[model samples]
Target: MTPFRTLTAEQIASLEALGNTAEDWSQVRVSEDFQPFQLQQSRLEGEVRIGSEARIIHSRVRNCQIGEGSLIEDVTALECRHRSSFGNGVGVATMNECGGRTVRIFDTMSAQMAYVMALYRHRPQTLAALERMIDRRVEERQSEIGRVGRNCRIVGARFLREVCIGDEVRIDGASLLENATLCDGVEIGVDVKACDLIAAEGARIGNGSTVERCFVGESCILDKGFTAAESLFFANSHCENGEAASIFAGPYTVSHHKSSLLIAGMFSFFNAGSGSNQSNHLFKSGAVHQSVHLRGCKFASGAYIMSPALEGAFTMVMGHHSYHHDTSALPYSYLIEKEGRSHLMPGANLASYGAVRDIEKWPARDHRKLKRDVIDFDEYNPYVTQAMLDAVNILHTLQEQDPDAEVYTYNKTLIRAASLQRGLKLYNKAIVAALGSMLDRGESNPRHNGAGRWIDAAGQYITRQAMREILDAVDRGELTDPTAVDNRFRIFDVHYDDYAHSWALQVYASLLGHTPTVGELNDAIQAGRNAHAALREMTDADRRRDCSLDMAVGYGLDCDNEEDRRRDYFAVRGLK
Candidate 1:
């Protein structure tokens, strides 16, 4: 620890001349290398300490101690007290309000933004304890500056009254920060202003951003004219060039468009396109409009959705729709609009090579390097596919009950007669494909011991005893919580071999009233695999046909041939 020192009476007087007024001279303290001439008019109350070879200019301080080898230049410290200790080579810039009142600057340490929110907003008792801890460090010279970790820099900040700044932080050209805690390695860019905000570690706020009453999570980025009010953004998310109000953005959420506005809703891993917007109220009596977009969802450009709609996982939506459609039962499907009418196409994406490609790409798309505070999501979930299979059964039942019923007439949407017939065939094919894929992959696993176990009375290849064990584990409040869920997924991600097949066997057993023999189970698995592979090939072929060269003929107006049309398109673009 460095030794203690005090400023001379002449230095105290000089500080007073520079717009600083101290209630008592004996209360002021400085390092041995402190110069009286550099001191400005500043009020020193209780006990104040300045660092060795440090500069104190134009600031009012009360009940705080400055650390040795630190600089307090042109900064006001009011009622601003630090009971904590600061490491060597720290710097602080402060300014006083118009009424000549002082502000408190506390020690720095990084915590999750959500944790800070819970601390300050939800648990006031906890914050009071932390504040008291800071207040108690006034007397001891060894406890002066808050000891932050190495290579931290804070510059050009007008810290308002009552703020908590964390260690290893960097703030540059920040204006009007009040009632906030900035966690470790947080970088606040130029002209960035925030109030009542908490920024987690490794988070970045770009230049000219404004945030109010928000919690920004770890490794999240908000830059280039982003503005958020009363929002909570979780880990590994990115929001840029947009405005958000009263929104909760979950993990891996991304919105990067100037005209996009996310308001009063919940979203995760959501991609909002340019001009994409949602209506929270339809000139209603109150503010009771909200929409939910589950994980792995995409919104096309210029898409507009009204409230009270629930879209399922891995669903792609295109065109504008005002109707409240509930497609939660259908996963990995496409909902398109034709002539102002919503059209439901079941299993439209099932055979598409793009769907498979997307599944393969999501795991590799992880950009977060730091460990997250919240649970990481599984982009591909067997549970979701199982739900889809259940939906297929329900839709099949509906068709058999009314062969003449319009397939698309659900929640004010229309399904053509042809579409209905095709949808059922496609859904069945998808179910078979999924089951086959599971069995084939499982058989290749090293854990496979010559066809594994025999079927139980419940018609499951895995015994009812095993099924009950798995369900009981989930029901015993073991997998419901976030931590448990995350741990389970982490293990599943690494060693999910044969798990999908096991789940399939369970589903098949549930569907069949009687248990099948081992040979029958193996035969079913092989048939399912072949059907799935054939469907995938068909889906890929359809995609190719959709992308034919002749499809661009109408797209390029007034062009004679395909070659001329292509040249015209490129030539028009080259002019720019």
Candidate 2:
């Protein structure tokens, strides 16, 4: 369908002086170098195709199809249709009266800002059945010239009636956008405001970010006054300032300070310090509640949490706690707060050295480049040292079931009876330093038949009756189905697979009861590897006596001696 070029009684008096009113001007069509005074008073319908250095200024369209060097500035297109390899080298700038009515096609160039956020949040009966499918592509572009490709751009967008954009994307100075799908090279900064979103590709919506019903993946980064609702962020997540409701931010999730607030939680590589917050609901009934921290966790600066807690994996929390503490069996512990209470310090971080420098800086702060659809999170395993050896065998069976009870009253806080006998001698010297580093790495690596294979306390492997059938499948609930607890912690995270290290080698062979001999499993793996290398050399001599510079001495009361106050604090703090 290519043969229509009529519109020239001086372009019908320059389109009735720039306010086009066409009931029929031979179904207005232009190309063959169309130029009725560069056209004006726009109002065209069906069988309309304008190309050859295309330009349709002062707009009001219906039943559309215009390609070839495309540009429809000051726009308003209704009942749209155009699907040829789709609306080429596109560009639309609307705002000249009836600033709303859908049907836009900016074919392939990396999803135009995800179509201005899904064509400005559609619904006018789905914007009149997508403008009757762009008036059946203006009667098949009346004769041809539809294929505009070469660096497209849509600017000063407003009340985008119903969006669906893609290709070499870049929507500048956007103020209002409805619905959404800005995939490919998406970059919508400057006064950005999106609704019902779905931004993928190199996602970046900085300058005053505001998205609703969100779902941003790929290279994510929602900057500044970031506000999100019904959220879901994956990929390299980075949410600035703060405010996320119904949150689920997986992939390297990072929340830049500024009174941070992440609601209805579920995060990943998560780091929310400055005024970190959370607390879904506590109305006793209504707003329900929620909270779960699994991945390489950390929350310091004015940290606060409240929502039926479950924290674990590489755990480390600071102050504020509104009761509800369920350290999901205490993985890599440290949940502080002195006077006000809550202090369960098992293996006091197995002689600290800052929890072995946060387990040697989480595999060098893995900033995952790609390859991540989901399931694959191992922030140091043995399922958090077997929930810190079942909170040190439930604090040694609640200190042998209350040896004259009152060692800081249980589950309400305050645990000093010299921290419950130095947390039961630092949880039996961290379960004999995790059974002597699992019998010195299973008698220096001797798998089976030699009847000499053991491992567990964290060295890893499986036996002792496949860890007592995973604590009898978590006591018959078979890991309470969430896809059988994510496939029983993905078969206890497969590496050296023995039925994925036999669910913590059957909970350390049911905390060592039946079958234990190869010299009582090499003397409980050399007493948990010499009490985890003597609690990491007594937490590196208590962090070198809590970072001693002669412990400061009240910041050296205006220097004098002590080498002129250590050379006036290394000349105003130079050398450490």
Candidate 3:
């Protein structure tokens, strides 16, 4: 590639003849093979550089660099106001709207990093070190000239000020994009108004969405008039026709309803039904409460919950729950409201077809081209299984406390006797199955990590000890940088199987009261396979309900006979 050269007298004369004007012609520089005729009716100001084969038609571009093969046509104002960081150092108040958990969002920040920043407020020194590192990187990015990378097309844009456009980006009819960073492969569609935002690679913002002070992660889609502020939406999360404020939406968090409001919460691998909303304020004080919904959770239509609640993974919530119960110990449960009282059915969603299908579909639905988030898609990993183990202990203790009681009360939610017994069996089977699965992986030699507790750091499952070592290193000035800490997280993901196997060994010893011999291990593996089969059968029965006559009522509307109705239903649904 040849170096940029000042516009020659002949090229300057030709550009003026083509209705192009510059504040100072000498300040305009172009590539060695730049074409003068490709630019028309544009005003350039304050040291503008255009690359080879790049065209600017009917636009006013000031203090900008246009990369090779880029096009800027009919844009209202493409200018850099002053020295700016392009949304690199913006602080998004995620998870808590009251300002305790603010994450400084940057261009290269991943979901795991944001998770640690938002949730690990207990570790102040580590957080401070991470913030200092981000601040240094942000300072390094300060510039007076906006940049449009190679192959970018900005057509019919209204107001783009102090923005950085990366390679292969597309911006058409964007209303206002101020102080924003559109990373590589981003698509900004009609009427999108994004301010103080960092959109990572492969993200799309369109359909009249309004985003302010947010970090839109890789391959995310925000459309259909969605409004978001002070939020962090991580990889592959989709939001349409809804509003999100002060939310930490991790990977695969999806809310597609027009009436849904996701605010002041942490959610991952979540689904929000229509009219699903949560209250962060009780009218006693300002909106200070925050909620945590773990991965693979779903809020049923019109469901409501008061904040300061923590829900378990893979739990399905229905109706209105104002009790603010924390069910973090019970995974794969149902939290339903009955007659104005909260009812908890433990381990019920293990048999749910939707829950099982969600785990299967999430990996297939991932659309990220440049994947940044380190995600593990296993359904029965150590994170949820640890919760299952805790729930098993709690259920057994409750049974021993009152063996004849019909209803058990825990955490302000009532659990029936039948639910308790069923949950015990289901959790035990799942635990055994997970142990056997880990055993089958042949990780006979356990890693030093994954001994005690496990945490789902956004989409990555890591042991508490491994996470502690990283944070401790940061606090002691040994890590000192975000990249080093992120690498540690990535390494944990790479060795996830080993960590899980170690945790499974602990679980096996705890369950059977001794280290498993070779024969016992073989028996456990066979039993685990049988348990997996039984769980699958339960889910299969739940799936068949979708083809039931009641569910087929809306289908086969044009058919009168039962046979024709069944045929039309099966045909339309692609079921036999």
TM-score of each: 0.65, 0.32, 0.98
**Model 1 spans with C-alpha error above 4 angstroms:** 1-150, 351-361, 373-380, 405-407, 429-502, 512-576
Considering every candidate listed, which one attains the maximal TM-score?
3
Better of 2 and 3 by lDDT: 3
lDDT values for all models: 0.57, 0.55, 0.91
RMSD of 1: 10.5
Highest-scoring model, lDDT: 3
Q: Is candidate 1 or candidate 2 better by TM-score?
A: 1
**lDDT of each residue in 168-221, candidate 3, tens digit only:** 999999999999899999999999999999999999999899999999999999
Sort every candidate by lDDT, greatest first. Answer: 3, 1, 2
Cα error, residue 487 of model 2, in Å, equals 19
Q: Return the TM-score for candidate 2, rounded to 2 decimals.
A: 0.32
**Model 3 regions lying over 4 Å from their true place:** none
Query: By TM-score, how accurate is candidate 3?
Result: 0.98
In the range 118-225, model 1's lDDT, one tens digit per residue, is 212334543344334334432221343333223444455554333444545666666665555566778887778786666777788877889876667777788888
Error of 2 at 448 (Å): 17
